[model samples]
Target: MRPEGIRLLPWLIGAVDLVMIALATVLAIRLRITLPIFSAAGDVLENTALASVFFLGTWLVLLVYSGAYEPHVFGAGTEEFKLVVNASFFTAALVATMAYLMQYPLSRGFFVLYFPLGVIALLVGRLLSRRVIQRLRSAGHFNEKVLLVGTPGYIGEIHTVLARESWLGYDVMGCLVPRDYAGLEVTSAGVPVLGLSEDVRAVVDEVSPDVVFFTAGAVSSSTQLRRLAWDLEDHAHVQIIVAPNVTDVSSERVRIRPVAGLPLMHLGRSRSQLATNDAKRAFDVIGSLTVLALTWPLLVVMMLWIKVHDGGPVLFRQTRVGRQGVEFTCLKLRSMAIDAEDRLTELEARDHVLFKSADDPRVTRPGRFIRRFSLDELPQLWNVVRGEMSLVGPRPPLPTEVEQYEDDMLRRLNVMPGMTGLWQVSGRSDLSWEDTVRLDLYYVDNWSMVQDLLILARTVTAVLGSRGAY
Candidate 1:
């Protein structure tokens, strides 16, 4: 694949904004015509057509400013969505000012309603489009292929990285290590490195990768780095990426800046520390209560169905590890038999092959469906409402599970556990125990509110697809 393959990538974002802007226009117009309750007495010269064009321009500017279309960038995280929302408000305000100056002043109510509506629509549209794009990329369409080119150590590290980050969508065909380190064994899990670094150009010629990413030690000199770039130019389509030697420092803290005569990369920690205040707790409580209130009907129906089918208590509770390693009896709608754990020994004896059994007989008729779509987890909203959990965070592991954790695995307990999380959204039951650790660590390392929202949004699709569910 070539760089051109990713062209018009920006247009996909633009089209999403365009569609959302159109939707907002219709929503605004419908509100005006059909909802007398929302009708305003104030006069505004801003015509609907003009408003639409303004919104279109606003969305375009925001998408560009937000860097939503940056090549090879895809995450549902807060930074991405914050950009969408920030862009939306600025555009709305600009439009309102334009209206005022042109004697088309919009009512304050219209502006207030319009801004939220537009932002919501834009976010919803991006999320839906993200799901479709993720599906396509996961299925291996529209994803870039990379030929790992580095020293054996670097190659091995990168191979491990590529193997773990399946959502990033880079299919590592194989790796190319230095000739001195040739024939070295590594986890060729699925991707294998084809050749040595001595024949970098030959590797490029043979593999024709979309991007060539080199680690620091492989090309030790600045001259070698420049030469690699020049050699890649022969292909004219392959991109060159350089990974630095800096360790443990987050990307947020590491900023590359150009100083007098050198390219100086500065390091600074991210400013947004984990929010731990009464305000956030209050916000969580109110938000969860509102959601729980609205979804009570569905919850009642689900409870009834589970009770009728399983003939047991509707709610399940277990003392799981929580933030700061505190224990909390997390609540959930029971989606397994009362004696399901008792069968664990039997199931384990019957299968040393896989950790899960798709045909487990312990699940009741309705329990199976609840578990599949994760409806069984809905009762945890009470925990969310009670401040025992968050809307998004690391998953709370059972106390026994925590006891068995390796040093690295315990990193997952750094934050409050949530009803949904990166592990649940990424692959759920499909993930290997190792991959599960990797994802949990990944979220703990790079967590943000935006990342939480993105995880939550992706979770919806994952639940709908029932992929990797037991």
Candidate 2:
């Protein structure tokens, strides 16, 4: 069942949005009045109050039409912000059109100030609301209880994901398995088998889940699934979600179409188009130049420190695999002794996929400090500028590591290696080889400008905290 607290989320968000909109309108009017071009010389307060009410009511209506107040979208994802932007623009345009059509004097400067202010206020309000809701959800106050109806393997995968992503607000209560499986519990995934699939209705009645996630092969046929849905509909308020067998592919790349009453999911190819590649390159160039400009002084200081500490090269150059298995000169601030490479074979292997040590003896004192906060990686920004790497992408693998890669693992080579990537912000040296590869591949599949910006933002926090940094 839906949590009572969660049921009130839409109302809370709507109230927050309305107040923010009204405040933004008033603020816009006050700012506009100061400008000679939009001077409201008399009765400013009365006019501003009327405008605030009109704008708030119109904006709220637009927001409702834009699906901003939908329960499914509350306290999650970019959809809320996108909807707010759309509604704001639409409301402004409608107001302007109405004034023009009715031959009423409407200050263009007022809208010029209002549109952005309204959107920003609404977005900030929603962000604050989301934070509050997430805190409540984390404390188990507002969460949708999920019941899994699937095989042990599928249940395990779904359960692991839901558990890891607690912000998704799904609390997996238990699972219902096929009758053939005699196990009472799934200890590997930590989900108890509530009942068999045949008794799914009874289990739902007993457990009273808000959501039922049916994994592939959960039922024997489409007919049985329909019957289960019908039974649940009459019994309780339950949302049914069918989990497709696909993994890691984004919704942007998947298209569902009905052909002759059969729904078919078409998967788009992974390769980026020319425009996307050009945009990515432009972002990399701009980001690299900006960072270089800001950090040159710090870079010089680090260079001198490294040279004074080791009397060796300030920069370390190594051959690393780039896109399509091509070799590139990867650069980094030298963080180890001159003979660190010679000691690689002497040290115990940490992992077969990526070699790293928490406390390698070859690291110099300065190296330890720099590597701890990833100052050593600052030089890779040069590689990004050189076009051999990106500001964000998969972690570049060594030539030897690439040679050891299985066919599936080589998919990491499909995109340019990055200076800081999903793997780096997630856990740098502490991640398992499998997890590192998975995160990298996910970045490859789901590359977006927003994702890169988010990773860069997280990188700052990760570096400052020095978590999982060696």
1-470 per-residue lDDT for model 1 (tens digits): 45454575568767877888778777776666556776554343255655666667766876787676676555333446667777777787777777788876455555666668888888898777766676666677667778766776666677676666555667777766665667754534444657776677888887678877786566657777678777777676787777776644445556778887567889764322363446546756776788788988988999999888858999988898887788988888887788988887766432212255778887778778888888888788888876778877767788777877888878777767777777788788777777677677766766565666677777888889898876
Off by over 4 Å in 2: 11-53, 74-78, 102-106, 117-141, 182-188, 271-276, 308-311, 361-369
Residues 1-470 of candidate 2: C-alpha lDDT, one tens digit per residue? 46777778888899998889878887888887787775554665565566666777888999999998888887555667778888889998888887789765556677688889888898779877876777677677678999999888899999987886677789999889887786667636889888888787899888888999999879988788889888887755688999989987756568999998667899877743321398889998999999989998988998999999869999999999998888989998998899988888988897567888888898888888889888888889888888889988888999989888988888788889888888987778888888898888777776767667767866887899898988
| lDDT value, residue 370 of candidate 2 | 87
Q: Each model's TM-score? A: 0.84, 0.84
